[model samples]
Structure formats: structure tokens, C-alpha cells
Target chain A: MARVARGDRAAFAEVFRHFAPRVKAYLVKSGAVPALAEDCMQDVMATVWRKAAQFDPARASLAAWIFTIARNRRIDLLRRERRPEAEDLAWGPQAAPEAAEALALQQDAARLARALSDLPEAQRQVIVQAYFGDLSHAQIAARTGLPLGTIKSRTKLALDRLRHAMGRE
Target chain B: MTPRPAPRHHPDAALLMAHAAGTLPEAFSLVVATHVSLCDTCRVELAAHEETGGALLEMMAEGGSGRHEAAMDQDGVLEKVLERAQALPEAAPPAPPAPGTDLPEPLAAYVGGGMDAIPWRRVGGGIRQAVLETGPDASARLLYIPGGRAVPDHGHRGLELTLVLSGAFSDSEDRFGPGDLELATPELEHTPVAEPGAPCICLAATDAPLRFTGLLPRLAQRLMGI
Candidate 1:
């Protein structure tokens, strides 16, 4: 990402190439149009090029860095349902950019993935079903035959353990 | 001595799982973003979610379905980008606004900019929303329409939490001022009205969108246009 901060077009291009499809996949899964997904994909990549310098490793990994960007982009787009605001997605005046932290982010992503995969299957399933399957808590309760309180408690504890395992304080 | 009470409720398991799986509604996602901004416990949960998402992406790739993680595209993307860069013009990008001219701290810390400077749209009278903002620290932020108005009565399909930052609002249960945090389960129901003469300014983060009650209220909400 630092390569991005230094106006490295090649690095910026690399960021785009890697994230675009997944961004597209994410948007599509999130119910985005192919066209809208493409558009948001463009926006996400544009941010990478423009705000590459803001990637901070001490605090976040590159995947987390980019995920945050994607999350904000998704939010900006959704808020549009309520109001049509400006297009302030520029390389603007306020940026605590983390462009130099890509390598660290990559390392973090690897560690994080391992930690998540290592979680107890039951706890991991609860997280996956709720998130990937988009199940409501009541629905999860009904589906698993677990009490609502138990499901909730299990999910929270699972997440807590996952976070600790990931080494994020 | 015991540690100070955490300023905000961390995003619980359901919310984190939903976020990791990318199934969280946008409205709720905004609220979650606000919470993660104020709480570290939630951030750790988020880190785990990202990790989970990364592994799923990797597995898909190894199987040859071609999804190289949510934000990282290793094979095809790298090649395409390399080609795109060689043809671009030369010149390093400029630094961000020089020191002393930076955006105000909280706003900068939140969406990385001040409120007045954000691009806002009027959602209704005295109501405007800036949607989603990426914070300096990689958290998410949103610009709520302020200057006093009611928070349309609603409940979540999941737990919802809000952290007051600049103003006040009250639900059937309590009144909340700046720095105060409110946590509501899916079962709670109430109307959120702005305090008279002062618009409620809050930094809200949630795990799902509102499931506004009743057909009449839902219809009325649609009619009110927000």
C-alpha cells in the first residue's frame, strides 16, 4: 500500500486487481447489481489508489484495512437509500493514511484466518450460520433447537475466544 | 483498582458473525461501525471475522473456483494490475493536507473529517445522512441528520447499540446524553424522540437494520420517506 502512497501506479493497479473481483463477489452476495457491484468495485479501488498511505500496520492488517474501506464504501452507498449526498470520495484533506502497512496487513490476515479456522466447530458454526447464512437469532434458535439465550451466549463466547486467539488486544 | 467501565458495548457474537459473513444490514452495519470505533473488544471480534472471511476465500481459491479472498485477489488481479500500471504517467502522489490544516480530530478520527465538511443529503426536514464513512483507524462512520428530530421508532432483528456523542435523545426507557451508551435487544420496542430544542446527535452502531413495528407504522415510515 505504501507503494500506493508514493503514487506508484503499479502498486495501485495491483491493489485494484486483487480486490476488485472479491469486492464484486462481496457486493453480489450482499445483493448488489453486477453493474452496481462494478461501480462500487471501482470506488473501492479508487480509494486504494488515493488513500493507500493511510494503511496502518500497528493497528490493522491490509485485509482489515481494505475491509474497513469496503465496509465504509458499502455504507456510503446504502445511506444513499435515505439521501443522495456528495461524492467526497476524493484524496481529500484529512487522511491518517496507512499506505505503508500492506506487508503487515498480509501477515495479520494469515494469522487471523488460522485463528478463525481453529475455533471450536460448534462456536465456528454459530458464527458462520449467523453471518454467512444471514440467519436471524430466532431463526438460529429454531433451526438448532437451542434456547435463544444459549445461542446468544455461545456466539459471544466464541467470538471472544476467536479475538483472543487472533492476538488482537 | 478495577478498570474503568468500557465506554460502549462491544459488538456481540451474532453481530460479529453476521459482519464476517457479510450478511449484516447496512443500517445495523453503521451502528456496529460506531461501536467498534469506541470499543476495542468489538474490534477484536471484527478481526476474527475478517480472518474467517479470509480463510473461506482461500479455500475457494484452492478448489479453483477463483475467489481469492474478499479483499485480496492474488492470481489474476496481480497480473492485470501490473499491466495497467506500466502505461500510467509518472509522478508520486501528493501528501495529505499538510499539518495544522488537518480535519478536526473527532470527525477525522471517525470518518477522518469534520461533520460540516462531509457531503450530506437531506433525508427529511432537519434530517440528513452521510451514509458510510471510513475512519482514520479503519473503522466505519456515518453522518446522521441532526438539528433535532425523532429517531423513527424501530427495533432490531438483532441487538442494537448507540453511543451519544454530541446531543441527547430519549427512548421509552431512558434519556441519554453525550458519552452515554444505550443497548437494546431485539425484543425491546420504543419511540426515540429528540430532546426538545436540541437535536439528538449520536454515534450509533448496530448489527442489523431496524424492523419497524406494525404495518401502519411501516407504511407511515414509507410515506414519511426515510
Candidate 2:
């Protein structure tokens, strides 16, 4: 990300190679046709390059940050509506994150990924459908039979780990 | 200035998840965004959901290359994106909010300025509202209730989200101060009265029209488009 922010085309190309296919797949699962998904995926990558400088590893992982970009682009292209984003918090004197904090966040992200893959099939399916934009909160509640609180608690365990790593607690 | 107290009430995990997934209706999204701007607790929760989304995206990538081969023209897309990147200028950082503005940035953009700039219309009972333009899925409004006055009793047909921005209000549930969010489902019914002191200001959103119980308020609802 630092290299990409410095306008390194090679770094940008490497990032594109890794994330482009994944973002395209996400769009397809969300109900976009192939051609539209391709177009939208390209737009998302361009935004990644443009906003590289704004990426803060302390706040979010690279994949997580990219997910937000792709999510916003999907809204623009697929839904054709404006998304209201929360105000950016002022981090006060620390313009750049501490190196140790960034490393800890990355490790926490890896653990979260493992935990997600290990979830029971039914639970994982519920999460996938919800994040893929195939289900709304109401539909998820109605279809899963599992109460929303149960799902929240499952995810909250991982979130608590992340919060501790980020020193929020 | 003394920092505002942290919000006690917040939107549940389901709402935060929908917001992170980009599936929330625009009106509801506005309320979530405005509330999250003021509440760090909710912001962290939102980040957690976004992290989950990232993990899901990664898992999809690992599923197989078969889907990727069918959907994307990789070299062609990369070439186009790179071409665009070459011509793109550096993205400028977003401008800081104006000093002394009370509304959150997202809500401020919709209002076109600060609270004083809203074109409020009287909706009866010492209450005023400015309905914001959003998608057909839901409606959002800025509401002002004079101190010590009670908003008409009402129930929701669908979901109703009320986020307090200034002062406080109390209903059958509890007192809600600045940054607090009150979620009302169809089963809940109550009359909210602003506490004495400052007038209560809130950003409220509803998926369906509010069901006012009183005949007079129902009449006013139709006339005022509440």
C-alpha cells in the first residue's frame, strides 16, 4: 500500500492481480451480470489506486479496506444511489499509525479469517449470504431460524479480539 | 468545549451489518451514518462487520478460478484500469467540516449547511420537520420538538430509527440524550416528549409511514406528509 501510494505501477499491478478476480466474483454473487461486473470491478481498482494514500492499516486490513471500496462502487453502479458514509474521525496528532499496532492488526485479521472458515456450514452460509448482498437483515432473521443475537454473538467474539488488538478496550 | 457524553442506546448488530454490507436503504443508512459519526462504540462494531465482509471476499477468491475465468476478461480490464489511473490526479483529502456546525458531515451535506439552514415546516404540536429526499424504499426527516412538548403517540408499520442529535427525549422506554439511537419496531408504541431545557433535535427515518393513533395527528400526518 505504501508503495502504491507512492505511484509505483508495479505495486499497483500486483494488487490488481490479487484482488481483481475476487472483487469481480463478489459482484457476480451480488447479482451483477458478467459485463457489468467487469466494468464495476475496473472502476473499483481505479479507486483503489486513487485512494491509496488514505489507507490506514491500523484501522483496517488491506482486504477490508478494499472491500469497502468495492462495496461503495457496487452501490453506485448496481443500485444507482448515493451512499451516506460516516464522518471520518480525526485521529489527532498521529498522522501515521505505529508500526507495532499495524502488525498486530494484520495478525488479528488472519485469525478472524481462519475463524470464519471454521464456522458451522449453516452459520457460515448465513454470513456469506448476508455480506454478499443476497439477504437483508429481516430476510436473514426470517430464513435462518437462528436469532440475530446468536449470529451477532458469534461474530462478536472475533470482534472483541480485534478490538483488543487495536487497543480500543 | 467539554466532549459530549457517549451514547447509551445504539442500533443493533443486524442494522450495523446491513450498513456494512451496503444493503441498507438510503434513509436508514443516513440515520446509521449520522449516529455512528457521534458514537465510537458503534463505529468499532461497524468496522468489525466490514472485516467480516473482507474475509468473505477472500474466501470467495479461494473457492475456485473457474468462476473468475468465466466472468472477467482480466488483461483487458487491467489495461483499461491502468490507462485511467495514468490520467487520474491525486485524490485530495476531504475538507474539514465548518467550525461550529452541529450536524454530522453526511447529514450536513444533505441539509446543505448547518442546523440553522434547514427549511423547517411546522407539523403541529410545537414540532417541526424537514423531510429529506431519499430512495423510494424509505423516508428520512430532521425533527425538532420544543422543550416540554410531546410528539403525538405513534406506532411503526415497519422499522423506525430515531437518532437524537441534541438535548433529550423520553418515551415509555427510557431517556435518550445526544448520540443515542432509539429503534422502534412494529410492536412498539409510545409518545416521545422532549425534556425541559433545550429543544430536542433528531434525525429520524422510517421504512413505512408512521401510524399515528390520534385522529387529529393522523389528519396532520396526511397534510404535512409526515
Candidate 3:
């Protein structure tokens, strides 16, 4: 990222080679078709190259930042495809998180990963569908054959536990 | 239930999860993003969700091969990015607003300037509102109510998200100060009254017109198109 921020072409190439496929796969797993996922991957890489200046290692890990960009871009792209009239407010300039809080989050990725895997199967399944499969609670309820209230409660409980275990208590 | 602290009054985990998933409507996303900009707790939780997403991506055993050979550049995407980066004009980020104005970051772009600059129109009973058009199926607005005043008693026809931006207000739910988001559903009915000491300002979004019980307010609501 330091090299890419400095406009090192070789570094940029390395980043694309490493992250593009994974980003595309993330999108695909989240429900984007292959072609759309590839398109999003390219866009995500382009954003990475452009916003490299804003990447502060103290605020977020490289993977987190890259995936954040990818996830946001996926939402924007999907919204446009579904409702072209609906403009994207998500990508617009907003408050940067407090440096201290971001620093805390930056250190907790590994712990969070472990916590997620430790979640109960039902809780983890709902989260997986919500975060990666792009499924809303109602949709998850439909797909999983659970009641809407049950799905919402599962999600709330899962997040409560994850936030607690991640030490954001 | 005891009134939870401001951090406790966040948007539901379901809403945040939908935001992480990128499936929330733009109007609702605007409210959530603005609330997030103001709330550290939500920011940390959102970051955790993003990290979970990153972990899931990394955990995938089989990385799919390129199926869009034609759409993908035969040469490389890096070249295209570099070229585009060079071609693009430099973005000069706007100067940050001075602290304590109580304006959240996400709402700044829509306001063009600060809160004082907004062209607020009188709705009725010392309440003023500036409706923000955030695409379809929803409506967002900046509402200003004098201290000790109350909005009309009403029930939601659809979802209504009322996020207190400055000062405080108490509804049927509880007291909400700056950065607190109250999700008012159709089944609930309440009147939000500004707390004493200072005028309460809030960013409120609704999917459908509020169902006002009084005939006069309903007529006035029609006149105001709120």
C-alpha cells in the first residue's frame, strides 16, 4: 500500500494480482453474477489505487480497507442496477472514524475472525447470508424458512455477542 | 427499561447488517451512515462486520477463475487504473467544520454548508422542516422544534427513522440525544417532544406519510406536503 500510494506501478500490479480475484470471489459468494463481480473487482482496484492516500494502517488493516471499499462499491453498483434513479449516498464524504476507535478496530480483526467462527451455527448462518450473501432479514427468513422475527432476533443476538466478544463492550 | 446511554440507541443490528451487506435502500442508508458518523459504537461494530466479511472472503477455499475474459482487460486492470488516475481531476476535500456545531459528517454534503444555512420552512407550531429528496420509496427531512414543544401525535404508516442530531427528544420509546436513532414502526404510535434547555434538531426519514390522529394536523400535513 505504501508503494502503491507512491505510484509504484509494480506495487499496483502486485496488489491487483493479489486482491482482485479474492474481491471478485467475495462478490460472487455474496450473490453477484460472475461478470458483475469482475466488473466490481476492477472498480474496487481502481478505487484502491485512487484512495491509497487515505489508507492509514493505524485506522484499518489492508484487507479490511480493501474489503470495505469492495463491499460499499458492491452496494452502490447493485443499487444502481436495481434503481438507476436512486443516487448513492454511501460513497459520499462522511466523518472519518475517530483515530483511536479505528486503531482499536484495526487490532481486533483476528479476534473478530475467531469470534465469528465460534458463533452458533444458526447465528453464523444468518450473519453469513446477511454480510456475504447480501440477504436481508426478510429474505434470509424466506431462504432459511425461519420466521421474520426469529431471523431478526438471531441477527441481533449474533451481533450482540460478536460486539461483546470483540471487546467493544 | 432504564434509558440506555446514547451509544445504546443505535440503529438495529439488522439495519447495520443490511448496510454491511450493501442491500439497504439509499434513503435508509443515508440515515444510518449519518448516525454512524456520529456514533463510535456503530463505527466499531461496522468495522467488525467489514472484518468478518474480509475473513469470509479469505476463508473461501476455491477462488473462481476468470469467466469474463472479454469484459476483463486482456492486458491488465492496473494500466487502466493508472491511466484513469492520471486523467482524473484532483479532488480537493472540503475543510472540516468547526467542532460543537452538532452537524454529523454524512449530512454535511446535503446541507452544502452548516445547519444555519439550511432553508427551513415553517410546518406549524414552531416546528420547521426541510425535506431532503433521497430517491424513491422514502423521504428524509431536517426538523427543528423549540424546546418544550411536541410534534403531532401520530403512528407510522411504514417505517420512520428519527435520528436526533442536536439537543434531545422523548417519544414513546425513550429519550434520544444527539446521535441516537429511533426506529418507529407501523405498530407504534407516539408524539416526540423536545426536551427543555435547548431546541431539538433531528434528521427524520419516513417510508410513508405519518398517520396523524388529529384532523387539523392531517389537513395541515397535506398543505405542507410533509
Best by TM-score: 2
Candidate 1 backbone clash number:
24
Q: How many pairs of residues in model 2 come into backbone collision?
A: 0
Candidate 3, residues A2-105: lDDT per residue as tens digits? Answer: 79888787888887777777788788887788878877777788878887877766556778788788877876676552211111124345565567865665
Binned by DockQ into CAPRI classes (incorrect, acceptable, medium, high), candidate 1 is incorrect
Candidate 1 has a DockQ of: 0.17
Pick the DockQ winner.
2
lDDT for each residue of candidate 2 in A1-169, tens digit (9 for 90 to 100):
8999898988988899889888988998888997898788888899898889889899899999999999998988888778999988866566568889899878877877887877667567767877895566456677777687765665555445444544557
Candidate 1 Cα outliers beyond 4 Å, as residue runs: A4-50, A70-110, A129-154, A167-169, B1-13, B16-23, B34-162, B166-177, B189-226
- Model 1 fnat? 0.15
Native-referenced Cα lDDT, model 3: 0.74
* Candidate 3 pairs with clashing backbones: none
User: For model 1, what is the alpha-carbon lDDT of residue A135?
Assistant: 61
* Candidates ranked, most accurate by DockQ first: 2, 3, 1
What's the true lDDT of residue A18 in model 1?
Answer: 58
Predicted complex 3: CAPRI docking category: acceptable
lDDT of 1 at B28: 55
Tell me the TM-score of model 3. Answer: 0.80
User: Residues B8-72, candidate 3, lDDT per residue (tens digit)?
Assistant: 58887777767656666667777888888766678766656667777666555444564466336
Q: Candidate 2, which CAPRI tier?
A: medium
